[model samples]
Target: MEGRLVLALILGVCTAIPCHAYYSPSKPYVPPTEKVTQLHFFLHDTVSGKDPTAVLVARPNFTTAFNNTPIPFGSVFATDDPLTVGPNLTSGVIGNAQGLWASTGQDVLNLVVYWDFGFTQGKFNGSSFSMFSRNTITQTEREAAVVGGRGEFRMAKGFAKLKTYFADFSTADAIMECNVTLIHY
Candidate 1:
């Protein structure tokens, strides 16, 4: 009976003892604010020569050439027209009409132009050129163009304008087009 009493007393004392637990307050999370800028690009052709009017047909050729080239991630390539340059070099008729598009968001603040004819299959024999212009309120005005043979030619240009806070922006003119050397891989 005495042993039982002692054991009960010991168990009671053990159960009554307090245990300390460690804890700390959680820190508040904060997000950083990012500034966004937007810009629009327009490509058109304005040439006095016979090849200048060939832009319509050249657009599709350009698109085909671009599609055949390997593009890096986070970048895209496209064109308003998707047809052959023309039935023949002497046709003097433009078939493909030009069009434009706005970037998905304000993430694209700089414009980089690239031409890939290195993979062109035949030799460029035709004489043609393409012209383009850029217009912006807070940036310097600029123009770009390229002229090359009908077989295999490669040209690239890059343009960067001042960043703007507005979401609506566009170029003053359209991009130009010319003959491209098609490379068969």
Candidate 2:
């Protein structure tokens, strides 16, 4: 009887201790290894030109104040904005920021964004990093998470900081500077 009780207690204690889900009992556990890299670029978003980079895709009809606010709640925009080496649009295009943004706040420019910065013309060609964030947009800066990626950025994870370089209210256009750093293979 004491032996039976002792065995039950040992089993209970073993189950209570946590074990990593990815770890296997048959194989030795080794930490994942990766390399780090940094990228600097600028994204140009234009709404007024004949060739617009970002456009309104969806808008909530239920919101009575939709037309009153610059960026009404529930409004969604899709973007294929060009990523340039410099803040100016005339600069060389390195890649494109393919993303979607939805205005989630009633007052402020708060947005939920899913963006993929795909590099095409540079050394990081064919590689991309994705970010999903609840961003509170400001005139100064904000940050978003680089969730995961593929190609040269396989298993990538990091953060991207965006600083507003220029904003033209009349045309509803903006130039944002992005600095991305990530750890990947």
Summarize candidate 1's per-residue lDDT along 1-185 as a digit string, tens digits.
99999999999998884556476557886643432212132223222234342122222323332233222112233333322333233434333323322121123233333332222112233322222333222234433333331222223223333222222223222332333222111
Candidate 2, residues 75-102, lDDT tens digits: the string is 8989999999998878999989898988
Q: After superposition, how far is residue 160 of candidate 2 from its true place, in Å?
A: 0.9
lDDT of 1 at 182: 21
How does each model score on lDDT? 0.31, 0.85
Per model, how many backbone clashes are there?
A: 16, 0
Candidate 1 Cα errors over 4 Å, as ranges: 1-73, 81-108, 115-127, 130-140, 145-147, 151-185
Q: Lowest-lDDT window of 10 residues in candidate 1?
A: 116-125
Residue 40 lDDT in model 2? 93
Q: TM-score for candidate 1, please give it.
A: 0.22
Candidate 2 has an lDDT of 0.85
Worst 10 residues of 2 by lDDT: 63-72
Q: CA shift at 98, candidate 1, in angstroms?
A: 9.4
